[model samples]
Target: MRRELKPLQLADCAPLGTEVTDTDPRMIYHGEMIPVMTPDVAQGIKDARRTLRTNRFRPTGKRMSMIIDGCAGKTTLLLQIGRAYQGLLETERRPDSVWTPVVHINVPPRRESNMDWSLPFADFFGMDHTINIEKRNYRSTDMTEPVVHHMKESGTSLILIDGVDRIHDSELTTAFDYFDCLQDRLRLSIIYCGRGATDIVSEGLHHRRRGERLRTSQQFRSSLPVMEIKPIPFREGAVEEWRSVLKAYDENLVLYHHEPGSLLDFETLLHERTGGYMDTLDQLICQTAQQAIEDGTETITEEGLNDMVVGRQDAEDDWA
Candidate 1:
């Protein structure tokens, strides 16, 4: 909030440029200059939204899963998809109405009951989960009816459940059973996200309805197509892929002394440092940019990058 309140004094700070006076210096740190839109991310959003479009009004809405390893920006991709879907929803809905077409909630960790699963939706809608008894005494409210009522009233069509892997093995059956029933009740497409969301969802499908089988193995995996966001490989055929991403970052940088292709020049070094993981790569560049700004260099350099250690890969390399 402090960052938003105090805008960068670009008018007085000549080196920072007048074009970016409205933007804060923290933009470099947050990398908000350019959206997190990689090729795979773009395609994933396209495919997931396509599934939502086709299945949203069906009896039992179809689902999708995203399987991206840690540090590869799975959450970023999910949020981007939500933003895109919300944008689409806005055009189709009443201008004055308050309708949430895309709802995102992190699947609760260590979930133990159906009520526990409903909390995410309640939290999303800002509905209180506790009912007041006498004199400030409170008890948990059954959120099912309110949650469903609000979802229907708001015209929610898509749900994004992030961190499916966090649902404990013991809790999968209970957690997904509620999700399955919710999807059926709302007739909305759900995109489950995590590192191994496919396996987790598959396990849930098998155990859906407390071991009472409703679908076969082929039907289970087929209904929810998985999208992958693996790290960009720095190999002979894919070096340009890494360079292109860096080039996008370079073009969007707000540094005073930044050369057009300065980041692209360090392509190989960055690939080695971040192991092509988007989250790690984002951290490395943002931190390096912050250091450059503090030192008044206003440009990224090999020396600045060398002083910082980011990601588990870099730490392991340091230990070795």
Candidate 2:
């Protein structure tokens, strides 16, 4: 039997964040993420896990890259994949055992040196650099060694590097080299999330080695598969899909119909306005809901949408 949807209270409209809590149905249901997993994203996750499992037998693995524009929910998707993998580990574990199946790190912006790239990895593993280095006189690489060991011990196979576009051009080689080191030593599959395919492709081309530099240059291009996350198109039944998402939050909510002289459907109009971007669509829905609340109505009217659009323009103008 299908369960009836519940209406959302004001508190249920909180701004969405990257992290998702399994226990909060409101957060999970009404979040920016619409629970519509794209085939490419799903296959990417599967490939990462497969590579990890394959490494257990033969130790040869490959890496994946996701090139998505800003505000396209790349971080949200990565977090979801990481959390889902962690959940899987929890199900197959003893109560006292620890499992760390995924390690997600946001590459620091404008990193100019090798150590800068390595520090995040060391920090993620909670390695005490002061004690390991000052007292034990350990090298910088020594701090990162434990990460590899822990990953191997904890059954961790996927390392997600976010903000790959943030690495400066001058330090691109250094960053890629560091990733190569990790791949070779830990036998882990990696997923690098960047802003655009052009940046990644150009960098990969620029670093290609013809002679001595050729070895390191081809490292990224030779094995890594790059995938781009495109916007969800508004096609047949798209309105129904979006309506279902809205209903999850507010069962009483209704989409306002066009009054007259409207050439497009609401879903098509939304897609055209927002370029079918998930984050923009989310913001529009939230803002429309807020407007509905202010007007003491459960429906989002055309007037409310126009106000929201104008308000967005005003905000942009202010920034400008």
What is the lDDT of every predicted structure here? 0.72, 0.55
lDDT of 1 by residue, 1-320 (tens): 00122223334354543333224454443344455567778778888777766665555524443343233588888887777777776677653445777788987664777787888889888888887656586666669888999999888777888888787778878877888888778777777888777677777866743234455445554245777788888998878778878987887666778888978878988888988888888888887877666666878999988778787465656567
lDDT of 1: 0.72
State, as a TM-score between 0 and 1, how close model 1 is to the true structure. 0.84
Give the runs in model 1 whose Cα sits over 4 Å from its true position.
Answer: 1-33, 56-71, 94-97, 208-223
TM-score of each: 0.84, 0.64
Scored by lDDT, model 2 comes in at 0.55
Candidate 1, pairs of clashing residues: none
Candidate 2 regions with alpha-carbon error over 4 angstroms: 1-71, 94-97, 128-142, 197-206, 209-222, 235-265, 309-320
Please report the TM-score between candidate 2 and the true structure.
Answer: 0.64
C-alpha RMSD of each candidate structure in angstroms? 4.8, 8.4
**Clash count per candidate:** 0, 2
Q: Candidate 1: RMSD over Cα atoms?
A: 4.8
Task: Give per-residue lDDT, candidate 1, residue 169.
Answer: 71
